[model samples]
Target: MALRPNPTLRQRRLGSELRRMREQAGLGGSELARRLGIGPAQMTQMEQARIGVSPERLRMVASACGCSNEPLIDALARMTSERGKGWWEEYRGVLTVDFLEVAELEAHAERITFCTTAYIPGLLQTPAYASAVFARLFPPLPPREIETRTEFRIRRQELIRSGGTPLHTFIHEAALRMQFGGPSVLLDQLRALLDDSERPGISVRIVPFAVDTFPGAGENLTFANGPVAELDTVEVDVSQGALFLESPTDLANHRAIFSRLDATALAEKESRDFIRSIMKEVESSNA
Candidate 1:
């Protein structure tokens, strides 16, 4: 099979896990290749996600490498079986690869937890709010490009609306007051957020400014929980782009951060009331 020049994040993650399994078993690449009756180059390709691995082949690798993590193995096998292009594929070339990766992560996530300090979470933003955000890009994107990006972001919310995956989001008080598209837009966004919070599988919490201490140093983060804890991934939004974290250490640290945020955030009923208060403040200011 032809090696893939550009593998998706999921593919690369699978490859990385295979490599991890081998390393944990203290086996060298060549040695494993010999045991599997495959060439060293083939092993390299499989580990780099350039070539696909069948479920049967994956199990063979696990057996050969002495990996006893049954749940992880089963999840990896499921990933190997997944085929066909996702909805994000349509925007493959139009948007940056990071955008597609984010969607894919959310699509496969068993649960999602995210925190935003200055801006509303993308999955919860209203169309106008999203457009205003894109319009303020540093170099400034073309009007058409802004529309494209906004459309892409809105489409990402489909997973949330579908109720297929549960989402718990933490939004700092600053985000609710930013008024991205001015008071009118912010009001609509907050109202939409409240409505979304009432959804069956979605939970929204607000971290008030009154909190004595904040975690994550105000960084925007999205944690996508996988089928197995080891497969979980964290996406940190930075000015350069989204950075994905998957190492055991990174995952553990982020999980801790989220735990702290959860502790500091308001309860669901309180958060709803707080949003209502913010909406009133916006309405009063606009009037």
Candidate 2:
């Protein structure tokens, strides 16, 4: 079968790994190109994820770079070799590139931690809440578009629930209380959270509004762990743009914030009950 022209998330990730490895090895673009028998421009494009890498070429570059990390290399090889359409491919041209990028990241992440302020995190939202969210954001999206985005959000959550490992999420109280999608949607979303909380490998905690201060600065943050490859990435989402961090210092800072957030959050059981309380309030209002 002919390989697809557009790169999948896995392929793009491999490209990122190659570039990171080369940079860590202290080789400049020109120097790396000379060693790999490739032009510098090609090397740049490969590193930027503008092109898919070949397994043989990847190995050759790895060998030349003196990278003996077999597991990492093997993972990259497999990622590069993956040749199929991903579900998210259907959303191309319909959704923003940023949304697509996040979906790709979620697909590869074995573990995820996130903090939200304005709305429920996509992975944990119920379809109704998700719909309401989209309705509010676009206000004019056709029914079909609303449904598409909602489905996309739910599918992202499945990455954790249907997999060998479950995703972990920590939500701030402010986000949980704002009640997007109104009472009914919020009630359903809370119920879904409670249901998922009982599953193995999934941990949901609520950070209280009384935490005083946190390291997340002013926006939502996500930390993704690639368990097999032992890679950790921290993503900070701001109004301006999303920031990706891989440095130890950056990771440590995010870790500290997470730890504090986790510590101060309502206990697991209490958090569920807290959500139950909200559900009751919503139901009472509806009645």
Candidate 3:
């Protein structure tokens, strides 16, 4: 098959897993390629995610590399076996790869946990709220681009809404009060938050300003739990854009940081009360 000029994050992730397994087994790409009866370049291409690997080839490579973790292998195989294009394909030309990656990751993730400080988690945002945030783009997106992106955000929410994957989000109190679009928009957003919180498969927790400390406060993070710990991925939102981290060390660090955040944040019940009080605060101010 011809190589994809641009590989999605999931594809790149599969390649990373293969590379890790090969390294763990202390086998070089050339040696492995020889064992598998393929060209060295073909092995490199698969590992670089420039080319897709068939499910049969995936198992062959895993077995050849002596990758013993059955769960990881199965998960990787499943990723490869996923046929047909996903909904994100429709936005291929309109949005950058990173934006599409977020949707793809969320779509397949077993579970999603987001710690958002500056803004509401995208999945939980209302159309008006999301549109307002997009409209404020500094460089200013073309009108059509803004509309497209906002629509994409709304559609992405369907992953969780469909009850296919569970989502737990930790949000700071500041975000609940930001009033991104103005009082009317903010009011509706807070109500939407309350509504989403009540939905099955969705959990929302708040970290009050009164809390003594907030760890990993500056960096926005979402841990998209895969089928197993080995396949787990962490996303860090930076100024340049989203950064995907899957190395053992990066995963461990992010896991610990989120554990702490989850521990310090309000309990789900208290979080509801906190959100309600904040709603009242906003109401009084607007009055």
Q: State the lDDT at 252 in candidate 3.
A: 95
Model 1, position 28, has a per-residue lDDT of 99
Off by over 4 Å in 1: none
Indicate the worst ten consecutive residues by lDDT in candidate 2. Answer: 1-10
**lDDT string, candidate 3, 76-105, tens digits:** 999898778789999898798888998988
Q: How does candidate 3 score on lDDT? A: 0.91
Which candidate ranks first by TM-score, i.e. highest?
1
- Model 1 scores a TM of 0.98
In model 3, which regions exceed 4 Å deviation? none
Q: What is the lDDT of candidate 2?
A: 0.76
72-155 in candidate 2: lDDT tens per residue?
788777777777666777889987666677877777777788877777677878888888887886348998989988888888
For each candidate in the order shown, give its overall lDDT on alpha carbons.
0.94, 0.76, 0.91
* Ranked candidates (TM-score, high to low): 1, 3, 2
Location of the lowest summed lDDT over 10 successive residues in candidate 1:
209-218
State the lDDT of candidate 1 residue by residue for 200-282, as single tens digits. 99999999999998897569999999999999999999888899999999999999999998889999999999999999988
